[model samples]
Target: MSKPPLIFAVVVVIIAVLATQRYMQKRRQDAVNDASPVRTLQAEVSAKREFPAPNRRSRQREVIAAEEMRYEVYFRPLSGGAEMMFALPEKTYHDMDKGMRGELSVQGTRFVDFRPDAAK
Candidate 1:
């Protein structure tokens, strides 16, 4: 083939390869995003209260900073050392104290199915 035709073929091949790569990358990202869970578990280490008996319960009071807003996080550990964090949108850190109670739930993290307390 002539030099011009050979060069044009090479350019077309390169363009095709680049386009395919980009498409594949986008597809992979979309698949990951779709498979990921809506919420994930986060790791936190601090002093907390625990309830040893069935009727009696303890609380862990701490301050949390979220998006320029400060709130209090309270957690009460159950029988098996499992604890749940709780906070209200209208409550501040200073408002929390002993004798307060609430219910909370834990969630998994990332696209992979793992426990809530998995090490980050």
Candidate 2:
């Protein structure tokens, strides 16, 4: 009934509403992702490059930055099309060589799985 308690109650209600909205948004994204089918294609690594993560090291503090690597690929779908270019992680981008063939399984922006040409 007091002003302070009413303000506190209102803040709590606002937080609860925000949490519920986040939960619903996540659920909807998951549903849409699930409904979308995974697609696979025969692809090859046309190019590869290693990019050093930006260093923000300060003399006042010693900091370590994560190592991130990327690659560009020419994806030729089994159905056939112009080579598509994309970048992916280097750790998972193993044994990358020009014209290194492989099969790529992908969902949205994430790489689901990749197998080297030798495996085929």
Candidate 3:
């Protein structure tokens, strides 16, 4: 009944609503990706990078935080289109190098696979 308790309840409710919205959005995106047809494109690995995943923990604890690392690979389609950036598994990310030409399989915003050309 007090103002502090009321404020706290409001904050908790807001957080819960936001979390639910985010979860629903993720589900919707998964469905869209599932329905999307995989497209293979001749693309070159343009770049790659790693960044610390978002975390609320302190900097010292970030070293031990779950999902502390996130990796992304950029591909430039040789046929001419805006380059696409995809979040990929660490192993796959490491397997690609800038300027390596290959077939890039993609489903909507999801990354299917990248096979680098063996000859060049």
Q: Pick the TM-score winner.
A: 3
How well does model 1 score by local distance difference test?
Answer: 0.44
Candidate 2 regions with alpha-carbon error over 4 angstroms: 1-34, 55-79, 82-87
**Best of the candidates, lDDT:** 3
Tens-place lDDT digits, model 2, residues 1-120: 646778889999999999999999888877776777897888766666555544455333333464443455556565666656556667665656666777888775445777877644
Q: Which stretches of model 1 miss by more than 4 angstroms? A: 1-4, 40-120
- The better candidate by TM-score, 2 or 3, is 3
Ranking by TM-score: 3, 2, 1
Clash count for candidate 3 is 0
Q: Show the lowest summed lDDT stretch of 10 residues, model 1.
A: 107-116
Better of 1 and 2 by lDDT: 2
Could you tell me which residue pairs clash in candidate 2?
none
- List model 1 lDDT by residue over 1-120, tens digit each: 646778899999999999999999888877776775564333332233332222223243443333233333545443344544543343333443444433223333112221234224
Better of 1 and 3 by lDDT: 3
List clashing residue pairs in candidate 3. Answer: none
lDDT of 3 by residue, 1-110 (tens): 64677889999999999999999999999999999999999999999998887676555534554666889999999999999999888898888888899999999989
Worst 10 residues of 3 by lDDT: 57-66
Q: Give me candidate 2's TM-score against the actual structure.
A: 0.48
